[model samples]
Target: MSGPAPLPAPYALDDVDQALVHALQIAPRADWTRIGSVLGLDAVTVARRWNRLTEAGAAWISCHPAPVLAAAGQGLLAFVEVDCANGSLLDVARALAALPHVTAVEHVSGDGDLLVTVLAPDLVALTHWVTRGLGSMPGISATRTHLASTVYTEGSRWRLRALDRGQIARLADGEPARGEVPVFPLTDLDHDLIAVLSVDGRATYRALAESSGASPDTVRRRLGRLFAAGMLQTRCEVARPLSEWPVAVVYWGRVAAGALESVSRLVTGVREVRLCAGVTGRHNLLVVAWVKSLADAQRFEVRLNERAPGLEITDRAVVLWLMKVSGHLLDERGYRIGAVPFDVRAAARTAPTER
Candidate 1:
């Protein structure tokens, strides 16, 4: 089994740092000069703040589609808990951490286990990750998996924009003045597709063909490849909040020794718990769920306590506000496939001479 876990220590930042983070979250691509002008700071100051913020990892600036759009068929989110054998928790975590689909990894208290978040194209890929990728890791004794159904928040885009009627109208009219800073690598074709898709996921192939300057067949082939690769997915219109069931909660807990699978079966079988995992910390298990109201949240919690008496429920989070959520944000460091070769012929589409 894995040994002791490598818990990430909390890092602190001051007010200026916080402001810089907020600005980047709102507009990742804002020019230093423009940001400085808006914030009443000089360009140099803005640049310095940007550098410091990035260096500290307090925030990241990248571009990709929102979560809902990304998870259409190609991707899914899940939380995983691992109980290590020896005290080699970090070794196991490091191994699992390097897997292609793993995103966020944390070592929690209480149970002192490892918690991880992964994104995969489909259930088959997810299953392979759990059984082959993680289960094969040395020192790892146990694991629990939870599939994420709906995301309340992630990245920098929100499900519901906080705008007035006028602003909403402006947004709907394709005139949102605000810009987002995407940090993911983007190709000219990818950029063109994203630009169009942002306005309407259901836009016709001909329309996309026009905007992207590609033949209908080419566009179709590229989109097909992207979808197959788990990159450009999600074609549905934005969904309205589940008004009938608006409760969003994450529950973290752990099971008794030698009862991992039995408890995992019981927890995963619960319909109320949309996502459940065996995590590391005071609560070695984590579950995310959405219900109709606050009453539903409480009732689920009480039921969990009753069913898993030894399962320690440590911490819980009631999502109050989600500032941003998106799946299409591009990582600016490189293109989705690789470094897109520079082509002057395609410069117009890449930089867009007009805007």
Candidate 2:
């Protein structure tokens, strides 16, 4: 057999590239013409840049079932710390990265060799996955799982902050309002629609209709309702090497249950925090941030300590490599070579109360 695929060369983005990425993060599916107007570039030029980024695996757009959908008893989310036999870490990480439900897998420096974030249709499925599915895998010596009780912020919310107010306003002008609406249970069609989006967040109504077998009008109406109900979220992700902030760090902290909400809100407001959640474990709060370099980690910690005096950071780990993120598996070069679309509807069918 041939050796593994060659890693893509390291790419450093310039100011224009960074600005374009920031625009996509703010409005992931905006038309190229509109983005061009805001950035004062031709629509063709904007689209060409995006094409280059995606082709290089420097950036991509993906859709995820909103955390509110899980919190509403439709699915289960958990963070699992895994210990592997000395020589099996890479093997184990690659295996986990291939699973549809395991959104992120990072080789870290901490109590475990790998940290895995898992999503399932419900608690029963989650429990089964942890106890049976993961337990049966080779090389995994031990595992400690923490169920995410509340997701105050997800990576999707983090923006590069490279665009100015006028540019941001221009991009947001016709964006759909993403707010909480009455909970209308997702239908089979909705599940199919989400599956389509999981691969291409910017897929048009006509494209979605073709894939999901719904009329364009039905797709449009359903998508609007889902967005309004806070059951769907879109994110623009770029390769770390292509981003201004390349270093990623994870923080495990302890905060009293009573202070968890306030502390979460505080941390989420920090521009560095890409994910902030309350998990069930000794360290109740988990924070993930992307920064410019190693030194920025210390600075961020200091700021975090000052902002939330009561929060105690027990452990911090720098991510050496990200094998997978969301449903896309990455090569060492950070190019998306394969995908296992997230299927939350499968989990929703097995709804078991959180333990």
Candidate 3:
């Protein structure tokens, strides 16, 4: 008989690497020169280090539809709790991960064996996915879903605190627009550009143009328009086990309608809070965090109660295994092994939501 698959060795990040990743989190596509200035390293060194990390699949950059995309009346985002049959966890996870619309798949302990995020064009699509899509799939015995109503913060904005305030300021993303702004419709061209960036958000304009069948100038203008329109947001990502924050936790909580915004904002302010969104479930507020240890996870829970008394955390799930994040598939040690590119044009076949 064949032996069991070999376990992946964890890749540790030193201070410089952590700093570089943190800088990219601040400015996803910041030029090497600016990042170098912020990190006190030469531009070439910064670029070289990034290349090494990405080449090894230790880190990467990807783009996804911004909150404005949903606010503009696009797809619906829902959290799915999947109960897998015995011995079928791996099969079920791999099958779901291969789907286009299923964005994230995590095997956890608590209410369910897996937490799957799904993004569909409408209720019809979501229902079909839950019924036929998942019901018919082998190994999945049952599923529960929670609709996301307001996404106050996601993992894209989560960053490591390796840099000082001044250095962080030097690499921060552009100031977000104030108040409710007008929404813009996304074009086929915009979708094409997004598909390319979903694979490599830092892809050069020339490369994007070549792959997207547009002129370099056109690509640049369209990307700027997408950003200005709040239709697209990109972020740098790394293998969790490789970074300082390796443990992942999800908190299902509730917040009063009037206090939702305020409480969410307060909770998100916590450095460990990677995602805090309003949902239409028993527990309305869903928060996800990345911490350094299991103890830290417990500590975070205590800190959360102190920080946002209005928010009542119902259940918390520690990700025992994360099969996929955004579009990247991960190994046992959380290193990237592959990617299921983000493509909304494949709506008929699309998968889950952002982090």
Best by TM-score: 2
Q: Give the per-residue lDDT digits (tens) of candidate 3, residues 1-355.
A: 1212322464477889999998888788778998998888999999999988887778888888877767767777889999989999888888888776677899998969999887776677787667667867878788889998989998788776788898887666443432344567777788788777877889999999998889999998888767767777788888887767899999999888999999998998998888888998688999999999999999989999999999888899999988888877777667677777676445454333221
Question: What are the per-residue Cα lDDT tens digits for candidate 2 across 107-128?
Answer: 8887789999888877878877
Number of colliding residue pairs in each model: 57, 2, 8
Give the poorly placed runs of model 2, Cα more than 4 Å off: 1-10, 345-355
Q: lDDT of all the models against the reference?
A: 0.49, 0.83, 0.81
Predicted structure 2, TM vs. truth: 0.92
Residue range 1-355, candidate 1, lDDT tens digits? 2212211233344455554444443434445675565555798997786554433322334333435433445356666666888878766655554343454455544353766666665666667656666655678788877665544333233222222354334323431232132223336786577556543343567888998899998877665555434343232111113123345566776677577556666666555565555544455566666566778888988887777666667677664422112221112111111111112122111211111
Rank by lDDT, highest first: 2, 3, 1
> Residue 27 lDDT in model 2?
89
